[model samples]
Target: MGNMSKELLREYIKEQNFTNANDILNGLKEMFRDVLQEALEAEMDEALGYRKYDGIEKTNNNSRNGYSKKTVKTELGPVQVNIPRDRNGEFEPRIVPKYQ
Candidate 1:
């Protein structure tokens, strides 16, 4: 089961009398979208800078609260991403446009 081919996967599904591949495919697609969204969120975090509050500031500290928003595109379609923000007014995100 660890090294099954695509053809064998289809055969096993057929043998199990399964016909709702759409649901599974959609679920996987959703999973992929979730992962992509996470990547975008992390990108925003890095772009805007982030750090944990430990009651002590480091040598070079830059951290703030983050936010999320929904956006659409013609190629990648729609995505719900977290927009990062900082308190030092030195970070700005460049993904999906600020007005989109």
Candidate 2:
């Protein structure tokens, strides 16, 4: 994929029917949330040395346990995200660190 063209962006705005500044801000916030969430998931994949559900034996015992709800501050404001967990409690998310 390539960068979104201005014409495509304008078409998207028209389709969304953004009525005011608030609508645009909300859309940007949602996009930020999605990007951050995807980054976190990719980090987990790297830490685990395999993609989710790959069925390959993990070199170590660590595996994806589940997710923990965490709120992180961003320029858009505080956005909630599901931080993936490892069974041994070692999957520290670099994007949204625990102390942040």
Candidate 3:
């Protein structure tokens, strides 16, 4: 997704899609949410010491439990994120935080 956003923006400009500032703002908000979600997933991988669905043998006892829906307030708006969980319940996400 490196240049995907730029390509989309080019298409939008070619079609004259954005009529006002709100449209651009909304697009940026959506992009921000996507980036935040990706970061959260990466953080989970680091905390768990494994990527999602990896077939490698478990090095430690802790493992990925699942995900929990979490709505977080951002500068753009409220974005719902899938917070990852560990079996030991010791994974504290620094991106969104547990109590945020």
TM-score of each candidate structure, all chains considered together: 0.46, 0.84, 0.78
Superior candidate under lDDT, 2 versus 3: 2
| Candidate lDDT values, in order | 0.56, 0.88, 0.85
Ten contiguous residues with the weakest lDDT in model 3:
9-18
lDDT of 2 at 83: 94
Best-matching candidate per TM-score: 2
**Order of quality (lDDT):** 2, 3, 1
How well does candidate 1 score on lDDT at residue 61? 57
Off by over 4 Å in 2: 5-8
Model 3 scores what on Cα lDDT? 0.85
> Between prediction 1 and prediction 3, which has the larger TM-score?
3
Clash counts for the predictions, in order = 0, 0, 0
Residue 74 alpha-carbon offset, candidate 3, angstroms = 1.4
Identify the superior model by TM-score, candidate 2 or candidate 3: 2
The sequence of per-residue lDDT tens digits that candidate 2 reaches over residues 4-67 is: 7989888878888998999998888887899899999999999989889998887888899999
What digit string (tens of lDDT, one per residue) describes model 3 on residues 1-100? 4667987779866665778899888877877888888998899889877888899987789988889999998888888888888999999999898996
Model 1, residue 6: distance off in Å is 9.3
